[model samples]
Target: MTQLPGSYESYWMESVAGADHRALAAGLEVDVAVVGGGIAGICTAWELTRAGHSVAVLEADRIAAGVTGYTTAKLSSQHGLIYAQLLKSLGAEGARLYARSQQQAVEYVAEVSVQLGIDCELERVPAYAYAESSDQVEQIQAEAEAAREAGLPASFVTETGLPYPIAGAVRIEDQAQFHPRKYLLALASDMVGRGGHIYERTRVVSLDEGKPCRLTTEGGATVTARDVVVATHYPVFDRAMLFSRLEPSRELVIAASIPGEHDPQGMYITQEQNTRSVRTAPYGTGQRLLIVTGEKFKPGIGDVSRRYEELAAWTRDRFPGASITHRWAAQDNTTTDRLPYVGRFHPGAKHVYVATGFGAWGMSNGVMSGRLITAHITGQELPWSKLYDPTRLHPLREAPSLLKLQASVAKHFVGDRLPASHADSIEDIAPGTGAVVRVEGRRCAVYRDEDGDVQAVSARCTHLGCIVHFNDAERAWECPCHGSRFATDGTVVQGPANRPLEPRRLPTGTEDSDR
Candidate 1:
């Protein structure tokens, strides 16, 4: 497998200059406190500000640094073979509402981008879910029919502008794509201009629910608000055992400069067991960047590096002369029934809300969440509210999947603790890589930095005590149970984990004295 020159950075982040927002310094009060700076949070703040409410957005890091910054940015309602399944599980009416919500979200984003004069490279494009095999072709046809029934502009066709031929495909017209970060930064600026506050590097550690809720930040700052929106990619608080109900998954993305002037007219995704997504964006003068993404798996469950290798190999075979320019990965939560949770956090809970479980199609769902959540908070009714209500439960539909997800979590939680480490000392760790090692009879995560300095931290995740495994592709420690990721130095990257991994003191005289 061929390796790239630098560490992973998303093409979107590399191209756009990010917005600057200060962290919360002292206590403050607002009408609504949005606890994440990703798409959902920014959109929620924008909507609330327009509705004449004082809003504050608190981000653990800079804006758009979460899933939004790492997305494929396909703004479409064609989410694999989902419409057909939704018809069976949620019935015709429910499925129609789902399609309507997504379509509205697509229009909302395009309208806002134009209204703000944001140069996000927004374009109207068709999205295709194609099949390369006979069985999947039948599924694609069914999905097209179902999508049309649910009021989507979908049609079944055997021909697409793909590099290779597909057996069949469900093509949705008038869908779109854009530079997500650029659009989001514009919204952040608009919100701030309208008296909405945004604070970066300000992590909301905990929430106290009340008529006027209290949110405590990591730096001993408190934000009192009439309502709160937990838009963090994964809900930090498990008020309803959300950790068990949602299954976390990860996928890899790679951007390469095509050798020639070859470009696909539309975005395409395969419906095979191992899914692959393809799209392109303007790179420079008459040049385009081709993004190919796939290799989905549970975080920490497999060899992360092998997936990157497979992606590179696949790209080499298909786009023969393409060379990798950028590589990155994203993680998302999948609900038992596959619909996003987008309303109040739980039944009978009025002030606190959560928007999560976007699966892999977060671009549309994230925007839909903002609209739905803001409507609920301001005492307005949206047609799709009941459909996406976080408190709604379908015991019959959810029981089996819920049980399977929890079983997997239980297996990992107990099984990881009983395993013996292969390395007895820190010296076994390779430079620029990390692994679990036994130190003084304790399981410790050890990494040797590029400078040959050894760092060690507790192997257990701070979120739920699940053992974390090293992900070599991104060089981060990942929790298998709930998808919390940490840097080699133990800083939290993505979470349900609000705290960093516990640092360990090396035994006396054991450290390399090169320092």
Candidate 2:
């Protein structure tokens, strides 16, 4: 897809002031080495520390700068339509256990917030999934029944106060919302205070998942930990075919300082083609609601203009007078059956834990993942362990996901080599637009404004060398392969593309095909 990156609305963490950094150096050891600094890693570290075990968190960048940086940050157990589907796919016991686990996670956040005196805008409200179609209504009705049977407090509704048309909705009460960053920061402080070491900017280069796993960072640092938790959004252990087990989803988020009066009572989502979910928390003295909108499937193939327009329209329709301020987008890891994977890395591999595929509900699932993983490592009998195990059969069939990922790979890999006959310079592009400038047979994405200033990025996609598509609505270049995103100036906004876009070696006048 041509859509690049999403906007960066302030959700959760408020103060993440740290240096641009790297991985560990030399050799080190800890009781547990948590790889990833998002809510899951941070929360796990906190718990491990509280349990009196020495812990170390290794982050590839500043704290809270990954998918955790890009979440809607809704701290609730109302995963949309999950209970009914899980019951059908994994049985009723599995569904009820999953619901209880998520609810306990939500309560855990509130308890942690109160216990730690964190100021992350934690609020209790209802979560809803509005269905605008009769078929979806039937689905939600079954879902509501399943939810109630699973011991969750949920109901079906035909009368939502939304401005849009709807057939019915599934409402789960006492669901919650919060600022993700605040809670994470509070946990990070606790972790550090309890003698847990957090190594910022420490990108893990290699993982040894044998007994007493040895994790090596790029900087030659070897950390020997009894257990390693890979909460790195997508797992670093790709040899297990973990990437195929889950699908990645990208969403655009816009934060508007809307009038508090316009915010409907609770957090809401709909089953429209482009669904809309809303929640509001006090940003300052006045209220600013974070309208998290825009979800395009990963390897976003075609274009995103329609998607952005849909989000903008939703914001305008939902709260007309809202002042649009911080606009951002977040990409999430999703699984085929909608349930996340959280447990050991694989069946045979012990002591190498992973938590991934949280769908769009990272906040709660993340907390649950941390708790479950911590329990697993400690060999404790914890409730809900079976529901989140990594070795569980694909809750749904996997043929479709495997086919989809293979198709994406084929499509992008074959077309990634930049075209030979592309334009030579920024002068070739018109004002208020961009073009894929070709130089010495290498393609670079170039954009020129009304002033004729030029910005260029290598056309080669960072993931698998596929060319990237430039998205104008968000002004970031998106890789059609695996959804890597780059800023117009070649900065890495997202990955599977782990590196920034390469810059041109010469001026725009160089022949694109000369190389």
Collision count for each candidate, in order: 0, 20
For all predicted structures, in order, the TM-scores are 0.97, 0.87
- Judging by TM-score against the true structure, name the best candidate: 1
User: What TM-score should be assigned to candidate 1?
Assistant: 0.97
Cα misplacement distance, residue 208 of candidate 1 (Å): 0.6
Candidate 1 per-residue lDDT over residues 78-125, each given as its tens digit = 888899999999899999999999999999999988788998888899
Cα-based lDDT for every prediction: 0.88, 0.74
Global CA lDDT of candidate 2, please? 0.74
| Model 1 CA lDDT for position 77 | 87
Off by over 4 Å in 1: 5-7, 259-261, 513-515
Whole-model lDDT for model 1 versus the true structure? 0.88
For model 1, state the Cα shift of residue 238 in Å. 1.5
